[model samples]
Structure formats: structure tokens, C-alpha cells
Target: MAPGPIRVAETPLVSYLLRRADDALVLGHRLSEWAGRAPTMEEDMALANMGLDLLGQARMLYAHAGEVEGRGRDEDAFAYWRDERGYRNLLLVEQPNGDFAVTIVRQFLYAAYAEPYWRAMMASGDATLAAVGAKAEKEMAYHVRHCAEWVVRLGDGTAESRARAAAALTELWPFTGELFEVDGTDRTLIAAGIAVDPQTLREPWQRTVIQVLAEATLEAPPAGFMRRGGRSGRHSEHLGHLLAEMQHLQRSNPGAAW
Candidate 1:
């Protein structure tokens, strides 16, 4: 018999973990959208592989969260049964993949932060989280390298590609600020040695971004107004559309599996 739904408490720790999982899941879906639409066959496969990596990370994180919550909620439950407001992914990730340049810039910016964030999490007090960090850090390192190479290529290519890359940078730069926004949830877990301090990651993240942009011959846009609220269950309209598409199969046919 199938198990009934489990009532899970949204504790600070669970929220923190879900935020991470949601980030991976949403971004993975975005990458998956490029499956057959990429500029070349090699890139098409590469994006698919990267998407799979993020999905794998999300599964691990969601499983760990279910365990910590002491609930029967598995990865599938947390992934498919949640409403838009129930998600806690960063706004940057949930944004629509505008163009090839946009997708590359978005991935590069995110992987830049994710690489260091996962590396720092390797020292987490929680054993499961530490193990997750070890695996994810390596994947994120590769993501950073792949996306950075694309960013440079796009930025330094022909006039149209350069313009597109520059436009992508301008559009995506404002969303990067939310990556390092620390809050009460972060503070509580940081004290417990269960979370990496987002503030501490900012310097390393910026250094990587600057170096990569320099190589691409693209200038980093000056910081101005930044978006927020994804951690608090608030997201742009894009998330709702994404959730509708992503959750359709599972929502329409509950418990149906291959």
C-alpha cells in the first residue's frame, strides 16, 4: 500500500535545506529546457549533463531534509507536492532562460557562488550535509569551468554575440545579490555549524566573477537595486508558470510511476 502524506514541520533547518534543494531543482529544470535547443550538439549534451548533476544534488538534499524533519516525506514528495509559495529557491534561478547568453551568464554567476558554498559546506557539523557538500563541490567546480568558458566565448566572439553577452550580464547582475543574503535561518544554522555563512562566501564569489568577466572582456555591472524574498516564499511570476509545467504530470496522476 502507498504511504499516506506526512505532516512535516517547517523548521529553520528544514527551511534552510529546502532553499538549497529548490535552488538546484529549479535551475536544473531551466538547464533541461536547453536540451535540444542549444547552439551545438556538444553543448546540448553538456547542458543536459549539468542539469542532471543539479537534479542529483537536489535529490540528495531533499532526502536529507526529509530525514532531518523526521517525516515520511521523501524527495519526490518535497519536489512535486509543493505549491509555488512553498518553495524557497533564489529568485535568480527561477527567472526564465531568456537566450543562450542569458542562460550561460546565469549559470556562470550561480556556479561561481555554488562552488565555494559547497566547498565550505564540506566542513559542516552535520555528517550528511558534509558528505553532500563533498560531492556537490566537485560538480559545482565543473559547472563553474564549463559556464565560465562559455561566457568568455560569447563575450569575446562576434559583435552580435558580444552585445548579447553584455546584455545578459546587465539583466542578470541585479539578481546575484540575493545569493549572499544571510538571514535568521542562516544565522541559527551557522551557529550550529550546520550552515556556511553566506557573507563569508561573497568575497570569493566576487573574485571569481571579476576574473571570469575580465577574461570575457565584459565589464561587471555596478550594483544598484537588488531583488529579494525567495527565501521567504515570495517569488516572481515566473516560478508559478514553471511549477505548473514541472508539476503537471505528478499532480495530474498522483503516485503514478514508471
Candidate 2:
């Protein structure tokens, strides 16, 4: 028999999980933009595969979120029905992919943080989260390595390549702060042992990023003002455009599944 819809009250945990899920979904869509456009055939495939990895992570998290919320909503509902203001992804992930260097730098910065974040989440008290983390940790590790190599290659390559790499770093650095920002939702989940403290991941993320920049022969941007608010449903103009594109097919033909 088909199970009836569960109806648990919405909680901070639902918000927390949605934040992570939105991050993956938005970033995966960003990466998918590189399909058929990468510099090389091999690189094109690589970017697509990584995008799939992130989408897979989003699916798991979104499903878990629906279960927790007991709203009978599935991953498709969360992915397609939400508007720009409804999304809680980090601002970093939704930024435009300007160039190959920009894309690589963005992925590296995100993957560096994601690797450690997922590793810590492996210890989450929630069994579902722990299982998700176990799978995500492995994928994030590969993402870190793949993007880091490109960062180094671009930064240490020709004069033009190095310049582009440097510019990309400067442009994206401000968004990194949101990755480690903690708030009330985080606090509640931390108390329940269901969430990894974002603060705890900052040190390792900095270490990995700094070391990679050094190896790439690029200068790390000085820390100053950092952007925030993605967690609160605020986002850049880019997100609205992205959502419109991504949701168009689903929105246009509602319930018209094959």
C-alpha cells in the first residue's frame, strides 16, 4: 500500500538541511553550464561528472529534508518549485562562471571547504546524515584534488593564465565567508549533535586554500569584508536568472512527466 503523507511540524533542522541541499543544487547547475564548452573534451566530461556528483548529493539531502518535514514533498518539488528568494544556497555557488579560471577557482574554494565539512558530518548523530556524509566525503575529496590541480596549472602557467587565475581569486574570495557563517539554525542543530559547526571547518579550509594558492604561485587575497545573507533567502541578481532558466521546463509543463 502507498504510505500516507507524514505530517511532522517544521523545525530548524529542515531549514538546515535545505541550506545544504540548495548549495549543491545551485552549484551543480552552475557547473553544468560548462557542458560542451570546456577547453578540452576530457575537461568537459570531468566538469559534467562533478556536476552530477553535486546533484546526487542534493537529491539525498532534499529527500531527507522532505522526510524530516513530513510534507510529502520530494526532491523534485524542492528543486523546481522554489524561487530565487526561497533558496538558501551560499552566494558563492550561485555566482556566474566567468571564465575557465573563474570556474576552476570557484570549484576549488568550495571543494576545499566541502571535503572537511562532509568528513565532520560523518559523525553526525542523525543516521541518514551520517550515511550521506560518508558518500559525499569521498566525492568532495576528488573534487578538491581535480579543481586544485587546475588552479595550480592556471596560476603558474603563462602570463595571461596566471593573471586570469589571480583575478578570479580576487573576485570570488569575498563569498567564501558565508561558507563558515553560523546562525540560530546551526546552533540548534549543533546542540542536537545533528550538524557540524561551520566554525570548526574554517581553519582547515583556510589551510587548504592558502597552501594551494601558494603552490599555484598566486597571492591570497587579504581578508576584509565578506558577503553573507544567502542563508536567509537573500541572493544576488544572478540567482534569479539562474532559477528562471533551470525551472522553466518544470514550470512550463507542470505534472507533464514522461
Candidate 3:
């Protein structure tokens, strides 16, 4: 007789959702920081809008994860109560926003991965996950367009701008590999048709990145040792400092809602 289907623990699913939520949340915060600091007022507003879109996606994901875990924790609890070590956001998201070029390059890389990832997730067997994926995919499409335009504008612009764009792309390329690294959580869900295998995204991600770089007149960076461990809750030191600021109000005034 054929073997029965493998049953994976619900915990892995919850963990997987939380990791995706954390990525959106942390990156949203980072993007919001550019609100008043962008090169122009129009760009400032654009970044702020995109940031809020990502935060909205996180809120939905966190709520769904809470339900899946059978935990009483709510979105606020997950967002405000988790310590640095508890966060599973990609190190790429938590990395310091260096300059305008750096921010655009980072966003471009993430959008390239996210747009396709969400498109795949829209077919998930899990209804809530599929719904969130649908909504997020729309928002990510806009983000991808915006970031890609910036990449091209800067990369093919004046000599100095092109140099800066190239430098940012090279600096951020290493982090892109982590987005495709799968773990046990991924394996279980992928088998169940409830999640996309991240590995499947690598080829399309590379194709998209290379095409955009070509349009921007930028060369692809050389591959090197890929830094990882973010999904395993091991993050760079920058996350600790970011969390301290992000959780300050909640930690200081616990349960003191207005």
C-alpha cells in the first residue's frame, strides 16, 4: 500500500507566516524613515505610501499567524512584544538604509522576489494566505515598478549617479541569495501546496534582475558567500537597535491604549 501523507506540525506553518510578516513589518519601518528625507517631496510621499502598503500586508499576515498558532497573541503583540531575537525578518530588510541609491537597490531586489513569490502564493490551498498574497501582489507590483524605474534612472544617468547605483547593487547583491533559501517550514508547506518553494523563485528573480540591470546599464555583481540565518531568528546587530526604537512606546506603556 502507498504510504500515508506526511503530517507536518502546525507550528512550522505559523512560523513561516510570521517570518513573512516580519519581513514586511521591518522593511515598512525602514521605508517610512525616508518619508521626510527623500530627495523630493513627491518621492517622499511615494515612499510613505508604499511603506504603509507593506505594513498593512504585515498586519494581515500577523493576524492569520496568530490564529494558526492557536495563540491569544494579536497583531500588536507580535509586532510590539517580540524581541530582536524573536524576529525572523531577512537581514536584507533590516540592513541600514545607506543612501538613496542603496535604498532603491534594496527595494528593487526585494520587489523582484516578492512580486513573483506572491503571485505563486495566490494559488495556495490556504484561503487566508491566498487572499493576503493576492492583495500584497498588487501592491508589490507597484513597488517593483517604482523601484525599477529608479534603478534605471540612476544607473544610466550621470557618471556619478551610475557609479553610486552600481556600488549599491554590488553591496546588496549578497543578501539576495537568502531570499531563496528554503528550510523545513518551507518544505512542509510546499509539499502541501500551501506555499511556494522559494527555490522556484531563484530563476525568475535572476532573470528579472538581470533584465533590469541591463536596461539600467549596470552589470550584475559577482556571487559570493551568502549571508543567512535571519529566518532562523539569528539577525544582524542592526535589528536589535531597530527593535529598541520600534518597541519603545509599547514596552514603556504596556496596555495603555488611547
Off by over 4 Å in 3: 1-10
Candidate 1 wrongly placed segments (more than 4 Å) = 1-8
Candidate lDDT scores, in order, read 0.92, 0.92, 0.89
Q: List the residue pairs that clash in candidate 2.
A: none
Better of 1 and 2 by TM-score: 1
Candidate 1: the clashing residue pairs are none
Clashes (backbone N, CA, C under 3 Å), per candidate, total 0, 0, 0
| TM-score sort, best first | 1, 2, 3
lDDT, candidate 3, at 149 = 95
| Residue-level lDDT tens digits of model 3 in 75-155 | 888888777778888999998889999989999899899999999999999999999999989999999999999999999
Off by over 4 Å in 2: 1-10
The alpha-carbon lDDT assigned to residue 216 of candidate 3 equals: 98
Q: Compare the candidates by TM-score and give the number of the best one.
A: 1
RMSD of each: 1.8, 3.4, 6.8
